[model samples]
Target: MAYKELIGSFDEVRNYIREFFIYGIKKRSDFSDKSGRTYDNRRRQIESWLDGYMSFQQSASGKAQIISVDSREVVHNPLYKAFKTKNFSDYDILLHFCILDMLAGGKELAFRNIAGELQEYGFSGEENVINERTIRLKLQEYEKLGILKVRTEGKKKQYYSLSADAVDLVSWQDAIEFFSETEPMGVVGSFLLDRKELAGCQSNFWYKHHYMLHAIDSEIVETILEGIAEKKYLELVTSGKKHSEEKIKLYPIKLYVSTQNGREYVLGHVSGASGLDFIRVDRIKKVKTGIRCGEYQKFENEYQASKSYLWGVSSGNAKDITHIEMTVRAAEGEEFIVRRLEREKRNGHVYKITDQQYKYVVDTYDAMELMPWIRTFMGRIEKLESSNPQLKKKFDQDMEQLYSMYFGEAQNDIS
Candidate 1:
């Protein structure tokens, strides 16, 4: 109803920012799930944060708003700002400062004393009274978050602030600067760099092809990691193609991050399923920790056995392994092409067919997943064969289509 920069639901804001800004979904009607006013409100909220990165373009569907950013040029990730803008209630805000001020400077206080001080400070004021139970609950929450430490003394628990040890930023600044731009959960490094102690902090590094948008999915990634570490099943609420939510019971075995695109996926087996599934981390909306899975080790072993056949995330089926052999010509001076295939080919074998030719072969879970990389070596490919006819057929069809586009109907005559 009213415009606000802070969003109550990170999931709702994340979806809007991803669809409109990152994925470039134009036309408000394409959202289909929410009303136009709802879209506008979310858009305005995102714009308020990313106003500098935002741009406008005229498309056939309508005027489109886009967020265009070159990750190489930016010193800090702009997407991390979205995580900072979570809405906090007035009472929550007041209690936060009040509790922190009460426990300032490594001071420890019993629950009763802390409650008395809040009351003395007019926290029990008629306008906004905070009860003892709420204070205790908040303290317990903080203790779990490592912001507060609890010590028991004679039937009473004392709570005090736990501050981080000071690190020499001058020595570690470059590592923090690099990690904040490069690693998953990099926002933690970004937060460290924001400390007031580093008032004169300057970034000494830049990324050439940074994938920063995935920073928004850090919370989901953390939860999945928790599930993985605890060897527990996770209940995942995943948004599907039609915007419908599907709840999956997954026993997460591993996290796969694409080196090429930085897209993250959780490799797990769904409940009662025979084969493992790779669900994109970004598609997940909510995760609930489930009971400890006794069969976790079995699943882990299964994944380990099958991973050798994985080219990417697609594990086609347990029994259906696709074999592919690609022969490519590498002229005398173009040994780099052979070297490139050797370096880039994961789990695949490459051998010299002749002085000027090489054959690369592999048995993978899915040959279809290898199409994009195979396309890059199109002109050099002397022959391409696959156990799956569809893979070869599709490659031929695509080759013919490209030939027609560039060389006209001569492709048909040549065939």
Candidate 2:
């Protein structure tokens, strides 16, 4: 099958990776949800980004095609490359250069002047004719991106590049290099390093588990960030098992990264909704600019308050707080167990009822999120209870099932 060459959005790239590489061995015909052309387009796009790690095999007599990946041979995940971002049209690249070139070292100009300059100096690739409307739209976009500064005289709006007089790079070089390699928003540091012509020079920072996908990760982040910066509502399009697409208008407050899992989340208030919501960045298929949504400081402050007691992102209801208690035996050489409980308990309280006994208590919005942590104590947990009795009952059932699986067999042996 001939591969389609068009590059789609990050969501397309992400889903294709999940389908063909992670939970792969899927038949080409199985992708009925997408057009044959679209499926091929997505497959080709994935090949462009992850060519080294991807391969396809055929069924008996070559009746079907199945895609797969073998990570054992790959040294690094190529998914993080900037190219995996939404494919840019030729016009986008052309305008970026033409507009910046015309505005750079020249007086502020409108779209007509820029379009005329492009018409005279000529555009590269595809269409050569100038479209003033497209130019105006791109200029407005650049103005929003801070790539161009706009000025208004009476009614006319003029734009210019935000000055190329190299930013003061003397003191920021070391910091930029280090940050670019390790931190979120570090690409700015990377660009600074590139500008300084020191990109490949060795640095002290190195991460063994590089989240290369975060390159695409931050692409989504930059949008919510733009909303946060402007204090506006953002249009978020997400896909789910039930809904083909779920559209959300969010007053984006802050981004939350999971410590247990390296997932990025946008914590915000649903437009017109009363409580904070956590939206995973990976699930986001699209983001668009929206009208001003007023101040986020109130929600930001409330979210911060929730953070004090939040164990994880599974806050069921904003007002629903459940108190959980787990009594564990902490005697003799196992004092480290109590110390560990103290260290990992976040805002939970740890009290010693007796020298050999202790109870770990926490009031949380999602008592269920703490179950895996409770299970870590195993045989030491003498009692487990939660103000949410349903949680307690579920835990009892799980533990009883576990006991029967192991101890029930032992009882049979004793009989």
Model 2, 1-415: lDDT tens per residue? 6664545555566666655555453556767775888777776666665555555565663333333433343333345443435557778888888777777774677556676788766663466765678878888898876777777766765645554455676556667655654455655665566554665555545455454445455667878898888888999888777538889899988777765545788888998777788898878878977998656678778777787677888654546899888899988888999999999887888999999999988889888888888878888889888888887777777777786897773232211
Q: What lDDT would each prediction earn against the true structure?
A: 0.84, 0.70
Q: In model 2, which regions exceed 4 Å deviation?
A: 1-15, 18-27, 55-77, 82-144, 147-198, 202-217, 271-274, 294-309, 317-319, 327-339, 351-359, 379-383, 389-415
The numbered model that scores best in TM-score is 1
Residue 313's lDDT in candidate 1: 88
The CA lDDT at 91 in model 1 is 66
Pairs in steric clash, model 1: none
Question: Tens-digit lDDT track for model 1 on 197-271?
Answer: 655687777778888878989888888989999999999999887668899999998888888899999999999
Error of 1 at 342 (Å): 4.9
